[model samples]
Target: MSAPIQLRPDETFLLNVGPQHPATHGVLRVKMQMDGEYIVKAETVLGYVHRMHEKMGENRTYAQYLPNLSRLDYLGALGYTHGHVLAIERAAGIEVPERAEYIRAITVELNRVASHLFWFGAFVMDLGGFSPLMYAIQDREHILDMLEAVTGARLTYCYYRFGGLYNDVDDDFIEAAKRFIPRMRKSLKKYDALVSGNIIFQKRLEGIAPVSAEMCRKYGATGPVARGSGINFDVRKNEPYSVYPEFDFDVPVYHECDSLARYKVRMDEMEQSLRIIEQGLEKLPDGPIMVEKKPKTIKLPVGDYYQAVETARGSFGIRIVSDGDKNAYRLKLRSPTYSNMHLFDEACEGMLIMDALAFMGSLDLVIPEIDR
Candidate 1:
């Protein structure tokens, strides 16, 4: 999916990075206008993995389109499905069970932690540190195993239903979750000592690619990218979806606005996610996972319905225009990666290629989600 490099007048020469590079993490190609290792300008070229998920949403019924949510961001598929289901549920005026909401919150937070773990490993690997990736993955595997047992898929989960989840959790799932808390806490300490405290790692990221609050506002950036700039806005705290308002958790923010600042934000967020999961698990009520009242068919009234959820990457929103039918008249998926990636062109300008890559890795992009 690599594209041929194009020349620009401002550059001495062009360097094509990725569309196949491991540092890119996916099929992302950056056309860099470079002058002797310094990047004068940069442009991100996407569409390599565009699946047209929005088009698919128009063709399929609400129920039939449920599985496609996973294809957007496989690492945080449950969040996408959660947004889609909530959008439809609101449009149809359906009430979700309390226990089901708790389970949804628990699973989503677990998935968010898994995503941050994966990002931590890959980001370190980008900076030429490989050993930490192994440690990160080792901890991430436990989360994957726990999620797989309930969702029936390790990644790209479609376990959520319109009214509730497709299934319920057992004592084993709860026990595994409780066990992971302390174990992951120990791993976080190790990661801090091993990677976060490393002199070379700190030097590479500390002051590199500092994005200002104004830049984030211009690009409509959210999640850690915005929080790193001290914006102090989280969809969970700002919008309060699902049962997030009931739990006690902190939204991590850093005013430094550099790659290290962004890194710290995600690192702190993983711990907060653990706190949320622990709270949800302790207060998990005993009740039916699914609502008893059922509509014979899923249909949305003619109106514009939008629901947003805070995914691992950022705010993921599903907007639907219904015509009083089972299928959507129009569908729009507002993905966080798209907004986050928008800041890259300006952010990467005038930086060295290596630092630019570090900044890119800090964004934690899932290209398919942006392309979709």
Candidate 2:
């Protein structure tokens, strides 16, 4: 439980921000104690979008529940699904093809780029800049097309199976991805000119609601929130999973620990994601995208298993306890947004409500990811 926020007896008034506010971007609420326009402290209220995802995982067979991962963080569904797939693979000792690992790396990085692009638009819009959304969505469409070509879904994809992908990427899919990288680079340069250096944007976010690295650690913050605070930790680098270890990329870090710093981390991260995709396409080997002669029945060994993957928001972990059944006996999802969002009650105290909202946007939360 979070420490209770001290409230002055008569000076502070309670204010509720959203189970419907546009700035929140989802069904979430925060109870705030305010001294006029300044906030004394906050308490995060959840469960508005909860859908019993963990319970659903427990009720369904491994293959039947695969689709659930995509719904957790739809913008970064590939990353979420990757964790679940890897956890099962580890527990069952199923061998994924070399080509499958390469493809997973490519698709997940593409999804990361798409996720960051959407966040860039929404975040700038939160601070009252609207034009970036137009530019970002335009670039994001290219990736959606590339992924949809093979994955067959634009948003909530169930393209990854237990051992490998649901299907292999054709030459046309590879060509489309290759073409997108340079176009995306050009688009990013356009974004920098239009939003990154704007005086209004910088002033609005520059020193507002700064979260120190200690606060980030205390809250178990990850992804851009932690990276903006100068913690050089990325699951791709620090933990090394999938073909991520085989690729060359840099993790962006900023010491400002403010909204602008978080913005910069994600912006730079998109570029790094492009690097991963480029390397993946170049080194992609010619082999199967699924394992040969897989088991007919997908019963996991009777034990506890876990896998963690870095998503667009942060580190997403899947834990499952199997009783050697086709379905998990118990399942737990550790979503980064849940931890990152909790930091708001501590980090945003004393700031103006608008500034606090700005910091919340910087965390790049997907509320379903939290509510699940």
Candidate 3:
């Protein structure tokens, strides 16, 4: 327990939701002022698990920082890694191979599905629905196995090198991915019947803590948080990178702006990700997975270079300032979780404490991503 806040007779009292609360999704604590069951104000208190990822980037060699990106958002590690690699590749003017880009797209989409599956399960578990978590995790395990086969790690993968991926996708990996997609589609239908159609779940989320398009714009929220509010923007579509431009997919958006809208956005995005992966598999050309004649030590031009990628949670960006050295002179990370989370102060006002938590779940926060 934290030190109790002083309260007046009629004034709202403070409730510390957690630095360890399971519903928080990660090591996050929210200091909320409550009048009965209604929240008057809410503030997020971070820095519990800070590892100084930006500083680590500046201190370590460019290649050495690859693993640090994964630690920022373990659930969506590959996306962060992709962003970092893209930044380095752009700054160094290194060309990634066509096959490599396709491979990166396939693996990253698989990772996205895995991350969303975990979120779906954990988010439902936060609302006292336990069975969906089991179902979601069971489906997610296949994703982990598939990623582990290629990346050599189940979580927090650093599978991409600066110019390309660390390895190529083998026939076994491709065959396994082909089998996983249809099964995942079947699982989504079951999830709709189990959680989406549940009266209690619907009542808990519908119209609760509605976020407006203006509010998302004010806070720089992106991904499902912004899409949930009818903002038709996606980094993959709006700002195409890698081989995403070659693929055909839809960016799902909902106009409702409520917790349900946010929930549906993610639910729809998982299907779109599957489509991207399937196309990537079909269009995967025969070529080297890595570029040859690349510099052993990365030395970017003396300027700032930035790259952004659509991760499972939202847009993850890497900005690097280089002085033509092997290590970064200055490094910054623009994490979507930080932007999406800032809206809570405004969105949660006057909401029930439980509804506020549901709203937080809809944002799909990964705390390390925010803290980094």
Per-candidate total of colliding backbone pairs: 0, 0, 0
Candidate that would win on lDDT: 1
lDDT of 1 by residue, 83-194 (tens): 8988888889889999999999999999999999999999999999999989999999999999999999999788999898899999999999999999999999999999
Estimate candidate 2's alpha-carbon lDDT, on a 0 to 1 scale. Answer: 0.91
Q: Where in model 1 is the C-alpha error above 4 Å? A: 1-11
Which segments of model 2 are wrong by more than 4 Å? Answer: 1-8
| lDDT at position 28, candidate 3 | 92
Which lDDT tens digits does candidate 2 get at residues 178-230? 99999999999999999988999989989777889999899899999999999
Query: Model 3, 104-154: lDDT tens per residue?
Result: 999999999999999999899888999999999999899999999999999
Q: Please, what is the whole-model Cα lDDT of each candidate in the order they appear?
A: 0.92, 0.91, 0.91
After superposition on all C-alphas, the RMSD of every candidate to the true structure, in Å, is: 3.8, 2.9, 3.6
Model 3 worst lDDT run, 10 consecutive residues:
1-10
